[model samples]
Target chain A: MTIDFKQDILAPVATDFATMDTFINEGITSKVALVMAVSKHVVEAGGKRMRPIMCLLAAKACGTEDLEKHRKLAAIIEMLHTATLVHDDVVDESGLRRGRPTANATWNNQTAVLVGDFLISRAFDLLVDLENMVLLKDFSTGTCEIAEGEVLQLQSQHQPDTTEATYLDIIHGKTSRLFELATEGSAILSGKDQYREPLKRYAGHFGNAFQIIDDILDYTSDAETLGKNIGDDLMEGKPTLPLISALQNTVGDDHDLIRKSIATGGTSDLDKIIQIVQNSGALDYCRKRATEETHTAIQALHELPNSQYRLALEKLALLALNRIQ
Target chain B: MTIDFKQDILAPVATDFATMDTFINEGITSKVALVMAVSKHVVEAGGKRMRPIMCLLAAKACGTEDLEKHRKLAAIIEMLHTATLVHDDVVDESGLRRGRPTANATWNNQTAVLVGDFLISRAFDLLVDLENMVLLKDFSTGTCEIAEGEVLQLQSQHQPDTTEATYLDIIHGKTSRLFELATEGSAILSGKDQYREPLKRYAGHFGNAFQIIDDILDYTSDAETLGKNIGDDLMEGKPTLPLISALQNTVGDDHDLIRKSIATGGTSDLDKIIQIVQNSGALDYCRKRATEETHTAIQALHELPNSQYRLALEKLALLALNRIQ
Candidate 1:
C-alpha cells in the first residue's frame, strides 16, 4: 500500500501545521529589511516543513489538546533548521538549495552569515518567552551538539578512513539531535516526562534513518528525485555510508579508488565510483541499515499509547524509507 | 589621570577576573576535536576581554562579592563576543586577528563558519546554566539586536548615503547591545532592578564612543598600535562616522571624492581621502562626539554606589576617550 504524505503523515496535525506556519512568519519579524527578506526567502523555501510537522505531531501524540505553545515551539524548530541550512550553504559554498538560490547565493556570504545569526538569536529570544527552564536547557544543549556534529562532519571531510561509528556520530549530531529536540521538547512542554525518553528514542532513530537515506540518495537519486545532484557528496569527498560501506565490502582497486576519491574530493571518476558502489553491494548494505533504523524508530513509538498523531509519525518514518525502496 | 588599563580598569576586579577566566576555559568543553581546537584558538586570541571584564565590574559595582555565577555570565559574554569575531573575520575575509592567524585562514572558511556556529551554541548552552529567566531574556533580545546591528553595518556599506542616526543604530546594535547585556545582566543577576537602566545607558553610550573611536582610528591608528591596517574600512567602503562627518563638512571635489570612495570601495585614493578627511575637520567633529558619548557613559555610573569597581568602570570609559585625546 502506498502511504500518501499529505493523507497519512501530515493529515492528523494539519490544523496545527497551519498554526505553525503562521508562527514561523511572525517569528521571523525583524526591523532590518535584509534580515526579513533573506529569512523569508529561506523559510519560504522550506521543504514540506517536516521538522515542524513532526514537532506538532509530537505535541498531539502527548495527548495535549491546546497547541498554542506547541505551535510556537514548532516555528522555533523550523527557524533553527533554516538557520543551519543558511550557514550550511555558506560552508558548502553551494549556490542552490531545494532547487532555489540559497541565502548566500541570493545575497552575499556576509549577509547570509549575519542573517543566519539573526534567525538563531531570534529563535532563542522567542524561546525565552516560553518561560520553561527545562525546555530552554534542552534546546540550549541540543543546539550545541548540533553544531559540534556539523564541525565533526567538516573534520571528516576528505578522509576515506572514516568509520561507521564516526559516521553515526556525525549524523546523530547533525540530523537526529534536532529531531530529538522537536519530539522530546514537545513532551517536555506538555509536562509529559514519561513520554520524553520514548519520543527521544523515536526521533533519534528516525533522524539516523532519514540522514542515512539522504546520503544514499546523494549517490542513487537524481536531481529530479531529490532536488540535489547525484555524486554531490563524492564531489566533496564526504565518506557517507555508501562510500564507507563500499570500502568495507570491497578489496584492492575499488578500495583504493574510494580512498583517493575521498582524499582528492572530485567527481572526475563519478561514473566508475557509482558503478563500484552499486556492484559491490554497498547500496544494499546501506539500505539494510536504514531499514533497521526505521524499524527501531517505529518500535520506540510503540511505547506511546495508540493515537493518530503517533501513527502519523510512524507513517512519516515509512515515507522516508519508501524513498529507498 | 593617565588611566592605565591594567592599573585602573582591570585592577579593581583582578581576583574576579581570574575566576571568570577559568570559567571561560571550562565553558567551551566539547567532545569534538575540531570544535575544541578552533574554540581554543579564538578564545585565546581574545583581546583584553573588556566585555566580560565589564560584566565582572558591573557585578561588583552592585556590591555582590560572591561572584560564582557572575563569573560564568562573564565567560558566556566573552564566548558570545568571540563567536561574533570569528564570524566577523569570515564576513570581512580577514587573514589575521589580533596579530594571529584567523580560524578561516588557518583551517578554511568552512571550518571557520561551522566552528563559529559551535561557539555560539556553546555560549547559549552555558547561558542556560545561569538559570535566570530575566538575564536570559535580556541576552536573547540583546543578541538579536547585535546580529541586526552587524547586518545594518553591512547594509550601510558602500552606500555613501548613510546618516549619523543610522550609523548610531548600527553601532548600538553591533557594539553597545552586548555591553548593555554584560552590565545590565550583572544587575539583573544581582537583583538590583534599579541599576538595569543606568547600566544599559552606561554600556550603550560607552559602546557608541568605543566604536566611534575605533572608526576614527581606522584613519589615524598605525598597525603596531591597533594590529589593524589603516584604510581597511575605506577599502571596504564602510561609511563610518569619519566619512559621514567629512561629508557634512565638505562640498564640491573634496565631498565628491569621499562620496565616490565610499560608493566604490578601494584604497586606490586612500591618501587623498585621508588628507581630505583630516583637512575637512571630520576628526575634530568625531572627537567631540566620542567625548560626549564617553561623558554620558561615565555619568550613568553615578547611580551606583561608590566603589573601586564603579571607579574602574568610569576609568575604562575615560581611557577609551583618551585614544583620541
Candidate 2:
C-alpha cells in the first residue's frame, strides 16, 4: 500500500474547487462581510475533499482531458456535501466537528441551519450554470435523497429491532447515492457513457466502504483525531451498522444496557456500551465486509484505461478500507 | 370589511388548495410519505397560502389559457414557502404555529429541518420536470435568494436599532422576493413576458401590504383566528415594521423598553409591550401605509386585461389591506 500519494493531484483540483468556495462565500455579497465571514469560518476548516477528488479522478480516468466542467462539478459536489454536514451537525446537536466548534454551537442553531441552506442552494445555482439539464436534475435528486436518508436515520434512532436491510438502505441513500452521482455525473458530462455504469459501481462501492470506515473510526479514534469524543454515536443513540450488528449478538445485561442507552439517549453509560461493542467482535466483522467492498470498487476501475489518476483513485479506496482494518 | 367572503372565494379556494395537496404523504411510498407528512403537517395547519394563490390568480389574470402550469407552479411556490416556514420555526424555536405544535415541536428540531430540505429540493424536482430550463433557473435562483434573505434576517434579529431601510430590506428579502418570483415566474412560464415587470411590481407591492397586515394581525387577532398566540413575533424579539417604526417615534422608557425587550427577547412583560405598541398607534400607522401599498398594487394590475381573474387579484390586495383594519 506504499503508493505515492500525489500532492499535486489534489492541490490543482483543490484550487479549481475554490470557485465553489468563492460562489458560496460570494452569496453574501449583497449584505457585505457577514456571509463571507460565516462561510469562510466553515470552509476553512479542511476536509479530505474526497467527493470532489473522486469527481476529478473519475473525469481524468475516463480520458477526458478537459477538466473545467469536472472541476466545477467537483466543487458543487463538495459544497452540497458540506451543506449536509453543517445541517447534520445541527440536527445531531453535535458541539464539535473537525476539531472546531460547530456553527450551531458557535453562532446559533439558526445561523448554522440557514448557512447550510445557503450552501445547498448555491450548489444548485452553480450546477445550473453548467447548462446541463440532466446533471442539474441528478444533483438536485441526489440532495433530496440524502436528506431523506438522514431523516430516516433520525426517525429510526433508538428502535432496537431495526433490520439489516433498513441499515443498508440508509447507508445507500445517505452516502452511496452522492458518490454514485459524483462519479457517474462526471462520466456523463464527459460523454464517456461506456464507463458511466462502471464508474458509478466504483463510486458506490467506495462510498459504502467510506461510511463503514467512518463508523469504525467512531469506535477506534480518540478525541484528537476524530475531533470529538469516541462513542459519541452511542451517546446520541444512533444505531450505526456496527452498533446494530453488535446489539443483535449481545446477551442479557449487555444487550439491555445497550438498548437502554439508545432509548435514553445522552443519559447512557457510553463507556459501558462502547466496551460491549468492542467485545462483541461486530466491529471487526463490519470492517471485513467493508474490505470486500473496497475490492469490488477497485475492480470497477478496471474498465478505465490504466493511468496515474485511476491508480490514485484505487489507492484512495484501499486507504479507506485500511483505515477500518 | 363586511364584503362577502364567499365559499367559492375563500372556502372552496381553501379546500381546493388543500385538495391539490401533492406533498410526499404516506402510502406505499413510505419514505416519501414520512417526509411529506412532516411537511404537510406544517402546511395544512390553515395558515394563509397567500403566495401560491397569488401565483394562481396572476396566471389566470394574465390572459393565459393554460392553467396546468399555473397549478403546478402554485403548488411548487407553496411547497417552497412551507419549507422556509419549517426552517424558520426551528430558527425561531417557537413551539406552536397555526394554533398547534410546529414540526420541530412534534418531531425534534432535526427532522423538521431535514423535512424542510426535502420539500425545497422536491420543489426543484417538480420544476425540472417541466422541461423548461429557464423556469428551472428562475426557481433555483429564487430558492437561493430566499435562503440569503433568511440568513440576512437571522443576522438582523433582536437588534432594535435596525434602521427603517434595513427593516424594509429584510422584509423584501424575507417576504417580497417570493411574491415577486411567484407572479414573475408564472408570467415567464405562461409566455407573458410583456407582463413580467408589471406582475413583479404587483407581487412586490401586494407582498409588502400582506406582511404589514400580518404584523397588524399580531396585535388585532386572537390565538384562535391567527393560529399560534398573538405577539409571538414581539415575544421572539423580532422588530417587525410596525414596532420598528414605533420605536423610532417614541421617547425615553418607551424606546428603552422596546430596545431592552428586543435585546432580552420577549421573556417578560410581553403583554405590556403589546399594549405599548397598540397605544402608540403603530398598528394604525402601519395600516394606513398598507392601504397605500394596496392602492399601488391595484395600479400595478393595470397591465392585465379586464377579466374576473383580474378583479380577484385586485380584491385580494384590498383584502390584505382591510384584514387588519
Candidate 3:
C-alpha cells in the first residue's frame, strides 16, 4: 500500500509540527541581518521537516500529551540538521539544494560557513535553556560523533576500497545519528527513560534505512525521485553503499570500471556504470540490505506501547522503504 | 619596565598552563584519524596560548588555588580560539598563519571546515564535564555572538561607508566577546560572582586594545610586527579601524583613493594608500584609542584583590599595548 506523507506520517503531529515551525523561526532570529537572511533562506528550503516531525511523534508516542518542550526540542533538532546541511553544501561545493539556491551559492562559502556556525551556536543556546544536564550531555557527545562521522566520510571519498562497514559508519554519523538524537532526545525530554533505548534503536535503524535508500536513489533515481541528479555521488567520488555493494557483487571489467570511477570521480562512465549497476545484481543486494534495516527499525518500535503515534512511526519506516520498492 | 610574557603574564599560571596543554591534547582524541591529525596540526600551531593563560590567571585572580578544574576550562577556551582561527583562515583564504601553514592550506577547505567543527564540538563536550549551567549558558550565548560578530564583519567588508560604531560592534563580537568568556568563564567556574563583571570588563577592553593595535599595525608595522604583510586588510577590503580612521581624516584625491581601494579590494594603490594613511593622522588617533582602551582594561582589575595574578592580568594588557609602543 502506498503511504501519503501528510496523512500517514505527519498528520498525527501536524499541529505540534506547526508550533515547532514557529520556534525554528524564533530560534534563528539574530541581531545580524545577513545571518537571519541566509538562515531564513536555508530553513525555508528544508525538505519535509522529517527530523522535527519524528521528534514530535516520538514524544506523543511515549504517552506524553503535552508537547510544549517537545516542540522546542523538535525545532532545535531541525536547526541542527539545517546547520549540517549548510556546511555540507559548502563541503560538497554544491550550488543548489532541493531546487533552491543553497546558502553557499546564495551568499559566498564564507557567509555560508559563518552562518552555519551561527545556527549551530544558536541551536545549542536554545538547548541550554532546556536546563537538563542529561539532554545536554547526549547532544554534546552526539554532535562530536556526528562531526567525526562526516570527516570519516570525507576520508572515504574517492576510495573504491571503502567497505560496507565503513559505509555504515559514515551513514551513522552523517545521517542516522541525528535521527537518533531526534527520537531519543524526545524520550529524554519526556522523562521516559524506558523509551530512550527503544526510540534510539528505532531511529538508528530508520536512519540507516533512510540513508541507504538515498544512496540507492543516487544510482537509480531521476530528478523527480530525489531532487538531485544521478551520478552526483560518483561525480564527487563518494563511495556510498550502492557502489560498495556493486564492488562486492561484481567482477571483471564491471569491477574495474566501478573502482576507476570511485578512484577518479566524474560521470564519464555515468551511463555505463548505471547500466552495470542495474544488471550486476548489486542493486538487488542493496535493496535486500535496506529491507533488513527497515525491518530491524520497525521491530524496535515494539518496545513502545501501541498507539496511533507508534503506528504512524512504523508507517513512516515503511514509507521510506516504499521509495526503493 | 617592560612586561615579560613568560615572567609577568603567564608565570602565575605557568604550571597550570602546562597541565592545561595536556587537556587540549586529550580533548581532541577521536576515533576518526583525520579528525585527530587536522586538530593536532591546528592546535599545535597556536600562538603563546594567550586565551587559555588568561583564563587560568583569571581563576587565580578569583582566589582559587586548586586549579585542576580551571586548567580544563583554560584548555576549552584555547580550543574555541583555535576553532575560530581555523575558520578565519578559510574565510580569508590565508595559506599561512603566524609563519606556519594553515589547516586549509595544509589539507583543504573541506578538511579545515570539518575539523574545525570537530574541535568546537569536542570543546563543548569537555565543557559539559564542568557541569555548570551558568558556564554553559555563557558559552552558548557567547559563541552565538561570536559567530554573529564574524558575520557582521563579513557584511561590512568592501563597504567604505562602514561607521566607527559598526566597527566597534564588529570587534566586540569577533575579539572581545571570547576574551570576556575566557576571563569571565574562569570567574563563573571559580564561583566568584563578584569578580565576573570586573573580569569581563577587563577582557572586553583588553580585546579592544589588542585588536585595535593589530589593526594599526596592518598599515604602519612591517611584516615582522605581524606575521602578515602590510595592506593585507586593505587588499581584502576590510574596513578595520585604521582604514576607517583614514577615511575620517582625509578628503579630495586622498579620500577618493581610500574609498575606491576599499570599494574595490586590491593593493594596487598600496603605496599611496599607506602614504596617505600615515600622513592622515589616522595612525596617531588609532594609537591613542588603543592606549585609552588598555587603560580602561587595566583599570577594571582593581575590583579584584591585589595579588600576583591580578598584577599578571594588568601586565598582560600592558604587554599588548607595548607592541605598538
**Cα lDDT, model 3, residue A137:** 94
Q: What is candidate 3's lDDT per residue for A1-325, written digit by digit as tens? A: 8889999999899899998998899888888899989999999999999999999999999999999999999999999999999999999999988988899998999999899899889999999999999999999999999999999999999999899999999999999999999999999999999999999999999999999998889998552564588889999999998888888888999999999999999999999999888888888988898999999999999999999999999999999998888
DockQ scores of all models, one per candidate: 0.91, 0.64, 0.91
Query: Could you tell which candidate, 2 or 3, scores higher by DockQ?
Result: 3
What is the RMSD of candidate 2?
A: 2.8
Candidate 3 chain B minimal-lDDT segment of 10 residues: B220-229
TM for every model, in the order presented, reads 0.99, 0.92, 0.99
Model 1, runs deviating above 4 Å: A221-224, B221-224
DockQ of 2: 0.64
Compose the digit string of candidate 2's lDDT tens values, residues A143-218: 7788888878887788777677787777887899899988999988998889989999999888888887787777
Q: Distance from true position, residue A228, model 3, in Å?
A: 0.8
lDDT at position B98, candidate 2 = 68
List the TM values for chain B, per candidate.
Answer: 0.98, 0.89, 0.98
lDDT scores for all predictions? Answer: 0.93, 0.76, 0.93
lDDT of 3 by residue, B147-167 (tens): 999999999999999999999
